[model samples]
Target: MVLHVVIASVAALAGRSVPSMALPKKRERAAPVVSAASSAMQMQPAPINPDWIIAGEPVARMADHSKSADRAAYTALWDCTAGTFRWFFAWDETVHILEGEVHVTAEDGSVHMLRTGDVAYFKAGTWATWRVDTYVRKVAFLRRPFPAPIAFAYRLKNKLLPAKTPTL
Candidate 1:
C-alpha cells in the first residue's frame, strides 16, 4: 500500500503516467527538403534557404537555402539566335552543355564551339564570353566567399587581369 501510494503520487506529480524518454537530441533526424521557388515566391535578395534552384532557361539567378555557405551554382540559358553581347565574368566554373549549340570565346580570343552533351571547364580568372547561335542550356557550379586573404587575392587576380589582353 505504501509503494502503490508513492508510485501514484510520483506519476501524478511527473504528469507522465509512464517513464520519460532519455534519448539524445543531438542525433536528431535530418530536416525535410524545401524548394526555393514555385510560381508564387519571388526573391528581392530576400531571405533564402540556400538549397539550390535552376529553372532551366528563363531564371538566371541561383537560390540558396542554407544561409551558411559561400557555394553558388546556376544553370545558364543559351540562345544561338540572340548572339549575346560579348562580356566576361571573373570566376572559375564548370560548364556542361545541355542542349543545342553555342560558341564560347576565351580571353585570348580563342573560340570553342559546343553542342549538346559537350562539356568544358573554365579555370579561375578565365575570361570568357558566350555566343549562343542556338537555343540551349548549360549548368554551372561556382564557389565564392573564399576562405582566406590568399584565396580572395587569387580570385581578384583572376577576375581583374592586366589591360594588355591577349588576342586569340
Candidate 2:
C-alpha cells in the first residue's frame, strides 16, 4: 500500500504532462513503434549507455493494468535461456537486477549494459531485445495479459473466425 501511494505520486509528477509518445485518443488501438531513424528521436541519444540505470522511470504502466484495481498490479522475474528477446509489447515495466548481467537493446537500437544493483525503466510501449549472460530477475507490470497458452488460443480464434462485430 505504501509503495502504491509513492508510485502514484511520482507518476502524477513524472507523467504529469502529456508526452508526445503518450497514448493517442481512443487508445483501444495500439500504435506501431516508430523507427530510430526519425530525426527527432535520433537527435538525443543517451550520453551514457545506461543513464536510465537506477532511474525509477515509467513508474506506472500497462504491465500492471487491470480492470480490477484489486488485481491491477503484478510482478515477476526472468532467468530464461532465450538469449535474445525479439521484441516487447504493450507494457511499462521496472526491472531491478538481482543477479547477472544483461545487454539491453532499445527499440531504437540504443544499447545499455546492466549488471547487479542496476535498475532499468521500460515504458509501456517499446520493442527491444534482452540478452542475458547468466540468470536475470526483474519486476514487471502488465495489463490485459495473454499468457503463452491463452495467447495461443487467441491466435487460433483469429485464424478460425471471420471478421465480424457482434451485438452485445
Clash counts for all predictions: 11, 5
lDDT of 1 by residue, 1-168 (tens): 654455455546545533677866566453455443322333222211223221222223222333212124433322223344443355556666766776777888888998878888877655566655546455555544233444545455566656567799
Name the lDDT of candidate 1: 0.50
- Top candidate on TM-score is 1
Q: How accurate locally is residue 31 in candidate 2, as Cα lDDT from 0 to 100?
A: 29
Collision count of model 2: 5
lDDT for residue 141 in candidate 2, whole number 0-100: 41
Cα lDDT of model 2 by residue, 17-86, tens digit: 5265654566353324322221222122212123332332212111211233334444443443324544
User: How does candidate 1 fare on TM-score?
Assistant: 0.43
Q: Residue 113 lDDT in model 2?
A: 91
In model 1, where do residues sit more than 4 Å from their true spots?
A: 1-68, 72-81, 145-148, 152-168
Candidate 1, position 147, lDDT = 31
